[model samples]
Target: MELSEISKSEIEQEIQQSFEGLVEASKALDATRYFEFIDAERFVGLNADGTNWNSIVGLRELVEPGFNAVEKVESLIFTNVRISVIDLNTAILVNEYEQKILLKGGTHYKEAGGGTQVWSKASGKWLLVSISASSKP
Candidate 1:
């Protein structure tokens, strides 16, 4: 079904659900599950590290070290989130995030960032296609 066929409210709700899934997987540090929300074949985005990523393999290579080293998620919060439905099959979401994590060896890591993501419906499901994000320690 094309997103254009759905009401804007419905589209927004679908996007919300997808984002919630992403947040859950991220908080659990589940790389495999977390990536399900993305369109791996088409994904091209700016990483938190300020590098452009066009390959999921490269993204995994860069993020797995930190992902694997996390002992626990102390907190992960997205604030001031806003969603916009652009067109049939397209939407955008922007938000600011703060996270505190417990890494291996009991060290804590904190980060703050803002993110803009472009999502499109694929096979009737919303998949993240691109992201532009900024990060700071």
Candidate 2:
């Protein structure tokens, strides 16, 4: 269905569910599952520190290393999520969340902050197009 035909609540709910699936994939360190939710052909991610991934391959490279380095991870917690439709086929989602990571040597760290993501409709599916995010150490 077109974005114009989709209600705001429906979009919000889809975003929430997609976000939850992402968290689950990350917590499981499942690369295959994680990439399934993204728009591989038109994806970009910018870190808070000015780092950027310009393509799906770049995103995968960045994510895999971290997941491989970590021994375990807790599911991310998203809160205060907000979504704004940008146009007939695009929307933006912002939310605050916390992440905990346990490294191979038993080192644990936690971060809290939020991220903004751009979601685009492609072939009748909502796919993540871009993201800008940061969290405190």
Candidate 3:
């Protein structure tokens, strides 16, 4: 698709939908589905607001433990999102969100946070290139 044909609103909506899909995959403990949206070879993740970024191998390793730790996703909301398209193939997305999760062994918690993600379109598919998220209790 041409950059002139795409609107900022459209990219924003796509990112929002993809983020929700990630949450759903997490809630279901479906690693395969979760990885579908990720660009594993070029992935970079800053999970839980951590300073050090995780590479593809680290990201993969976290899938089982991360989802296994979450029994259910009680609530997941993303808001105040902004999308800036650098080109037809690249965009930067920023957003704030809050989530309530039920963890394994009956632990429950609520977290609020914001994130910045760099998305790239390759072969007509939008793939997550890098992301950094910070959350508070």
Using lDDT as the measure, the top candidate is 1
What does candidate 3's lDDT look like per residue over 1-137, in tens digits? 55654476677677668777876886677988988878877788787647545677777776677777888889878767777887767888888888888988999988899988888877477878888878755
Worst 10 residues of 1 by lDDT: 1-10
1-137 per-residue lDDT for model 1 (tens digits):
44554578888999999999999998999998988998888888888777898877766776678689999999999977898998768899999999999999999989899999999996578999888888855
lDDT of each candidate versus the true structure: 0.86, 0.81, 0.78
Model 1, stretches more than 4 Å misplaced?
1-6
Which RMSD does model 3 reach against the true structure? 2.6
TM-score of candidate 2 relative to the true fold: 0.86
The candidate with the higher lDDT, 1 or 3, is 1
Candidate 1 versus truth, CA RMSD in Å, comes to 2.6
Against the true structure, whose TM-score is highest? 1
- C-alpha lDDT of residue 119 in model 1: 92
- Candidate 2 pairs with clashing backbones: none
Regions of candidate 3 where Cα sits further than 4 Å from its true position? 1-10
Off by over 4 Å in 2: 1-6
